[model samples]
Target: MTFQLAACAEMLWRDRPIDWRASRLKELGFGVGLWNWPAHDIAALERTGATFTIMNGYLQGRLADDEGADMLLKSARETAAVGKRLGVHRLNLHGTGLGDGGIPVWQHDKVTGPMWLKARDTLNRICDLAEELGVTYTLENLNLMEHPGCPFNTTADVLTLVSSVNRPQLRMNLDLYHTQIGEGDVIRWCQKCLPWIGEVQVADNPGRNEPGTGEMNYPAIAKALKAMGYSGPVGLESNAEGDPEVALQAFRNAFTV
Candidate 1:
């Protein structure tokens, strides 16, 4: 199966108009990942005739209380509605962590367990909302150092969460950079959890920049993905060191059709 290349909108935010960014993606024969893009921007993107492959909905740990959880759920549902309207099918999300002057949400602390359970329940609600909105909800694995409070830092953790949730709409958003940084065995881990994968993001190790500009062997990684019959977008969720066009060229050269 052939996979689509996608540019993360955050990369070109400083240098290009949103329409121009879409045009560049079209020129490269790619899609786009709308990272925390506002709902109002959907029309502008629609005008470019580019597909929004991934939509990210905001979530923080400070909102785990009943009132906060309710608000977060509402926001997630609304975001999913917006995503569906924009023709986006997958929504990526991060786990909530502990707030200031308190125990972390995913740690061994007493508050952590309850908070995690509540968050898990909230995620299930979000998944239900996603289905209602005609979208898939994917939980992303964060780098251990980057997200110390997150309980899920490994593919195993992600698999465990999915098993507990047991929902078709709730799946994993596997990010190569975080996997590498977290010391995950990328190929083996991905193979083990292939069935749960809903989306995939790519970047190089150490610097989290465009592939080939860093130490990641993207060709090998691409080979693994193809072997696993992954037919989703290979999202370019990385920073562009020089020009976005240059990053696009590198991605094209690295992956095979």
Candidate 2:
């Protein structure tokens, strides 16, 4: 069976309008992934009729503090409305809000046991909101190298949190690029995260560009994912090394197993 392929419109065709990018991706026979929703016009995107796979779920919030959790929930509630308007498939969250350059707004080099407990509790609350909103939420893992001092940044940390919560409303946004950077075994991580995975995101390491531009053997990884019975969304959250269409084609070729 073939996987549901998508590409992040925010990452590709940077010079064009966001809705145009979404329309182009749709025209190319792929679903579109977005970042923050507030940056674009909802009606314009809705008119594109692009199948939105996933997008950032919160505008501003953290996961381990009472104030942050409240902020997160409020932000999520507002974003959920936009997501529903666009018919987004999944809403994604991180351990905390990401700032300029993808840095964690609340960075913590050492995550205490209490912080872990709080994070899990916060995720449960997020799940509660998702259940109420008739939508799903995904907690994504970030790479420490790129997002240093980020709590629950590793694939292991994200897995532990999602598994601990163990709710259908909450799932893992298993990003293979971050996994490859933080942990080398991509296929095994895919197997481990397969059960609770809401989506699988990818970009080649060393450059965070299209798959073929780097060392990752995306075709083989795609084959492995198919064998693992993962027929979910495989998204390209990478920048184009050269021509955007060529980059997208390379991404499609890699996962067209």
Candidate 3:
């Protein structure tokens, strides 16, 4: 499994323009990823030589409601329109956390099973749309500490979503920082999420800063991912203290195996 480092432009070199950030990431031989679609700056990205790994997908609306299907699809189509043109291969999604009546989507009662089914069905539609555009969409697991009320915060929950949906386009965008906070079983969770793990993100615990800034052993974590045959890009989505150059070097050292 071959792994490459990707730079989350939003988290790095904040004072510069998007194109400058892209150029800087290109200079470091890192791929570029975005949490949000660069709708206003597609030209800036196109001018750079960096590869586009993933960008935010439709997540503003609830996926667990049948009535909200149109909104979700619209987001998918628009995301695909931008992604296909810009060559972003993956679209990352964060399903709606709040459901009808201002309740959490996964209440695990009369609504939980049906809501999950709806989510799965909606994802199938989105996945088909993604396949048509030559892109895959990932459902990410965000921890409760930082992202409360989110569905699929645990590894088991996310695995269930992917396995139940059973689509090639539906996969996991597993972030190590959130996992360490929510589950603390990084390697085991990676093993469980192996085949379905499409993309990875990392940040140290305690501060959510660059690797080695906190207690997370990125070296061992990287080795574990390697052993698990995760060949996708590992996104650096964390704060870089002081000079980004120094932080980048330290990140490379800790995450390079």
- TM-score of model 2 (CA atoms): 0.98
- Model 2: per-residue lDDT, tens digit, 1-257? 29899999998889999999999999999999999987799999999999999999999999999999999999999999999999999999999999999999999989999999999999999999999999999999989888989989999999999999999999999999999999989999999989999999999977999988888999999999999999999999988858989988888889888
- lDDT per prediction? 0.72, 0.93, 0.77
What is candidate 1's lDDT per residue for 167-240, written digit by digit as tens? Answer: 88888888878888876578887787688888888888777788888778888888888888887778887778
For model 1, give the 10-residue run with minimal summed lDDT.
101-110
Each candidate: RMSD to true structure?
A: 3.6, 0.8, 3.4
Q: Which residue pairs clash within candidate 1?
A: none
Between candidates 2 and 3, name the one with more favorable lDDT.
2
- TM-score order of candidates, top first: 2, 3, 1
The lowest-lDDT stretch of 10 consecutive residues in candidate 2 is 238-247
Q: Looking at model 3, how many pairs of residues clash?
A: 0
State the lDDT at 124 in candidate 3. 89
